[model samples]
Target: MKDHVMRLAVGSSARGWRVAIACPRDVYPQDSDSSRYLLEAGVKLIPLSLPGRISPHGDLMAWAGLIRILGRLRPRLVHTHGFKASMVGRMAAATFGVSSGYRPVTICTVHNSIAGQFGSGSRAWNLAKLVEKVLARSTDGVIAVSRALEREYLELSHPSAMLVTCIPNGIALERFISVPPGGGGGVRLPSDVEPPGDAGPPGDVEPPGNAKPPGDLGSPGVLKPGRGPVVGTVARLIPQKGVDVLLRAFPLVREAFPGAELVVAGDGPMRSQLQALAGHLGIGARVAFTGHRNDIPALLRTFDVFVLASLSEGMPVSVIEAMASRVPVVATCTGGIPEVVEDGVSGLLVAPSDPGQLARALIWILSHRDEASRLAQNAFEKVTSRFSIDRMVEDTCLFYQEVFRRKAKQAACES
Candidate 1:
């Protein structure tokens, strides 16, 4: 998407900046708009693919690759994503020593602190905590999408106390508003003479072999030949995400709206457990677990009402995408959700981990179509106005500038 944005949009051109994106693997193990963005913007992409993703084995592999990259590209700044990347990336910059006078500022955005957030009072969780404590000191910048997460990082004693900025993830505003719910996204004649190539996108991936096919997946909200209102949640099926809470709540929603179906997107360690839980809950027949796919937009379109029941989060990308798809959302108030949803206005906000409350909200959205539409419209307006990719990129770029300025000042004092 980054490539497409730069090639087609203003201010994102290759001439505007010299940039580089470093990831363990090529940013696109499979081609994506992100890879395209790097190519078109002419940013040098240095893939630092590591060997294992397991434990010490993965750790050593990642560290070696990252150090090698630092020795080569050695850009003025580095922004790392995910815990593994940040640890290795930040350590490499720090190894260069303070004598460099901050020539290369390191930044990390915590996508999901799974090991920290998950695991119930266990030694494994504690080790993750310890790792975070050590890694926090090496990086120059730490960005958290939620105030909750920023607080978590601060409590962990991150070195840059004041550098912790809360920047929520954003969606492309015009895209959300223009693409109506369920692809009722009214057909507007594009200037293109031929239909956009299929190789292009809206297609990111195919479902894993173990998963069901798209149309066959029996999503209730999908307006297909045989479909009903499917209250869906797209997220990792981890304990912290509270997928179980949603599962428990489904029985109630099903009782109220018997025809209602439940669709779950994304896959994780808890996939089998969730399927088993659905069976246990007696709504197994109504449940569809379409593992992760690039066709999020289509899935979002299928949701007559969307639900996010995470116990903790950082303003999820799913909610924003749903609002863009014009699907009314019923989410729990945990992370940065309150920032996006305006209670009874934009969407309904219920307490986290309460299945009853979540079920009630879902039922309300279903029973009242007019209200849902109005709420969807409100959500659409809110997301389009406040949460946008342009805003996100601009804020991020400004941070880079600040880091650059700080580097220059530190250099002059040293000289």
Candidate 2:
């Protein structure tokens, strides 16, 4: 979410718009290094004491605070992202006390559908869906990250569906494109491998430039002098990611290609359990767990193939990022994944939670070098053409302007 906000801020500012960011204090501290990055990037940071989890009293206070801020700013537009921010921020804007101006063009970007985050059977999911339905009617405009998500919102029978537009998430493509494969850019120092304990918490790493790969496509095993083909996945060790299924599928992949190595990046609560499972499968020695590392671009370059064994996703940025790095991908055909990864066209897609099919896909990519290269090239072209940050910013600003234009006309009519 922060990535999305930051990209918009930077892109808007580049186009000569004054952009400011308002975020929960707990999540984004005022003195943090990340806040400093925002400040340096020409974004004014506003911090609020917003609660992390659901708290009726805390949310009420936050809503009051937002109303006060909106009243003072009295801006022509206000946009909120995510479920909590959309719920509170839109209501606050609707009720903000302003005597002499037209109502602001308040908009919300729904990043995920209620059913995607929580299962359909949960009471909380049903309640959230209801709230979203009501809120949708009050907002001036809506942005769903994918067409599938837009369909989900329309199914709720919200009148605001007419105001909704689908804009797939975008990333900084140039950096990924410029990244050097493997060890060509420079020799990575030992210290760079493991940071000092004093370093701040992990975040996205900048792309390493012009790195070279280990071996040529014609080389045997498609490996470097002493290394095997690395199959990697960057995801949180959570059930939603289906990391367990990936782990289960690893051994099967190993059976076909003994020299293959599995690397899991990112960390979460299931870390320990996953480690135990790997050890039980007796493939722990071949599998590497990189707790959390920011240098994803460099890591992706090192991989022969990337896998996303997620049970569900909303157009996963990780898969897009991997494709941007020109790494062949094997992702599950769930949610908006199929929208991004076209099976046998740009990349391979397998059934969700099916380890056998996933293993087969991985094995096929590793074995068929020419086909993998073709898929990677196609995937790169697709991402560069469709999911660049510049395109997203242009689309978003157009939406804001269209909404504001309609709003100004409505006010003129009343007068």
Candidate 3:
């Protein structure tokens, strides 16, 4: 939610823009990029890990905790993200307004529709939507990640467009920028690997950026932890992400390229089903599930090809991270993917829910080594030139500045 928006805006701002994020403790545990960026930027983080996701842990004392917290953290601006956090956080901000912190502006980001719950006809789905309708009216503003999502959110009542802005998520460049080509490091960059350090310093290049420092250089990056043409996919193993579709396609990929291995990261309810599908396809032995990793850059370094076979998305940061790492991506052409990858230029795209086409694209990239390498190099260059973290931060920073400036001017005119 807002964390995704803030992540894109982190370096965009001058680094001092204070934020009190309301997330579950698990959402930003030590290794996630969200945690890394928050730590790097030195922003004050407020995690809401009440016992039941965002619900209270004991004695139904959530109300007391909210009052105590909002009173203490009188932040300049409070932004609510996701389901639990947004619900609790919005109410907290409203309470602060009536009793204290009237100066703080409260905003919420609707990453998904409250109506879009996990299952059909589920009571939680209806409850979540009801809660969201209340929050939208109370929050100062709303940030929507995609037009598709915006329409869903506005189906009910919300403030005017002036109060709700469409701000898509962006990948942070610093988190993905390659190291220059070597000011003096001796480790050689991997032939197919791209990471934050692989690009090397722009000057006298003695080593590759992806190469570990002198001490760590003895170990290779690309071939590390295992061998074979490694494929990395970062998405929750759920229906929407199309991991099942990827599993069905993997058998065909193995038929074409027997030396390949797959690394599936992240977890969800459908994970077991997808894993079973792998066994049914007879490729289960070749697949490894890392279960929600924080070492994505290192994982990217090991992968030769990156794939995002999702049924839908709104500009995924993981795909951008793959591009930044100079990995050739084979993502499905759906939702906001076309907005990210240019076919035959940055990476290849295929239709969603189509296993054969997805397999064909993967096989094509795997067989044409030279073509894959060229595309990977071009993708890296594109990230460095256009999608750099610095640029995202700059763009997002300008967006926030403009919004806040307009906010101030409107207040003045009204007064």
Candidate 4:
């Protein structure tokens, strides 16, 4: 989500959109990457308190804050991301307009299916559906990051008055593609692209201390080396990501190939629990839990096979990043994953939460080096052709214009 925001803000600002992001102040402190990136990209940062979970008091305060912010900024559009932000932002926009007689068009981007994240009949899921249903009357437009999410939203109780479109997430291909061979090193940005302000060139940025460049993994298509093949994944250690499932699958992977190592990057509430599970499974030494990395492109270069065992995803950026880096992918066939990875052509897709299947996929990728490389190449071509930041930005800007024009037409007709 942070990555999407950063890319979108920068891309929009570069295109002269006068972008401003409203997020929790404490969550993105002055020293945080999100803050630094937005500032560098010349996007205004509005520090608004928004609780991640439901809290009557906190939500009330957040809603009031959003109302104040909306009144002050008087933006032409109030684009919200995430569930909590969308609910609060849309209501605030509507309320602010009623009181001040100046309402901004509201657009909510749905990144994931609520039912997939929270079980279909779960309280959170039901609450999300209810909120979306209620807000549909006021929301001018909706953006789904994946086709699956688009279908989910269409099936949900949204009004026909709203316009919903799918705009798959895209990345700044230069950042991932220019990662120096062998791994851990600064990326070289294209000469045409300049670094923002005094932030310095992105190409000069060095990899983290832990991500050492690895030697060649033997022959072109073989996985045998002095050190075992590295199977890696970058995702928050949360239940939704199904990292535990990956841990359970690792033992089976090790059974087939003893030296196979797993590197789980990114941190969340489940980090300690997942670490313990790795120990209990007796693969403690084999798995390295590097929490929250900034050098993902460099880290990706070290992976022999990239895996995403997510139980659900809305077209994971990590999978795209891995593909862009020309690494073989093994991800679950859930959410919009099948949309990104064509099974057997670009990458391998297995059933989610099935450790046995996950392990088998990982082992197969490890053993069949030639096929994996071919898949990796195919994935690279797909990402290069389809998922570029430029395309996403263009599509988003067009959508914004279309929604704004439609709103204007509706208001004029009513008047």
Runs in model 2 lying further than 4 Å from the true structure: 26-33, 97-102, 183-221, 413-415
On the 0 to 100 scale, the lDDT of residue 3 in model 4 is: 75
The 10 consecutive residues of candidate 3 with the worst lDDT sum are: 196-205
lDDT of 2 at 202: 20
Candidate 1 pairs with clashing backbones: 1-33, 1-34, 2-37, 3-36, 3-37, 24-49, 220-228, 220-230, 221-230
Tens digit per residue, CA lDDT, model 2, 256-375: 666667888889999999999999998777778888776787778878899999887776889999999999999998888889988877888888888888887777677666767888
Candidate 4 worst ten-residue window by lDDT: 199-208
Candidate 1 C-alpha error for residue 125, in Å: 4.6
Regions of candidate 3 where Cα sits further than 4 Å from its true position:
1-14, 22-42, 51-64, 99-103, 112-130, 147-158, 172-228, 268-270, 395-397, 406-415
Candidate 3 lDDT, 1-415, residue by residue in tens:
3446556435533555655555457767767677777777765555554554544443135545665777887666666566565677677777767786364666666665444444435787666667777766666677666666666667655556346666655565565555332112221222225322121111222221111112222222232222346677988777778888888888777665565677898888888888888888888777887677655766676666789988777656688788887777889876566667778777888888888888777766655555666777877776667655555456545556665776788789999
Q: Rank the candidates by TM-score, best first.
A: 4, 2, 1, 3
lDDT of 4 by residue, 81-167 (tens): 888888899999999999999989999999887888778998988888888899998999999999999999989865698789999
lDDT for model 1, on a 0 to 1 scale? 0.67
User: Each model's TM-score, in the order given?
Assistant: 0.80, 0.86, 0.73, 0.90
Per-prediction tally of clashes: 9, 7, 15, 0
| lDDT per residue as tens, model 1, 1-415 | 2222232233333237666666545445447676665576576666766543545677676666766666666666777766666667677677654534443677787766444365546886676677777866666677776677777777666565336687677765555455544663221111112232111112122321121222432222212333346687888777777999999999877776556678888789999999999998887777878776666776677677889998877668788889888898988887677788878778888888899888877766666566577778888888877778777667777777776677668669999
Instruction: Write the candidate numbers in order of decreasing lDDT.
Output: 4, 2, 1, 3
Q: Roughly what TM-score does model 3 have, to 2 decimal places?
A: 0.73
Whole-model Cα lDDT of every candidate shown, in order = 0.67, 0.77, 0.64, 0.83
Q: In model 1, what is the error at residue 384, expressed in angstroms?
A: 0.9
List CA RMSD, all candidates. Answer: 10.4, 7.8, 10.0, 9.8
Q: What is the lDDT of residue 365 in candidate 4?
A: 72
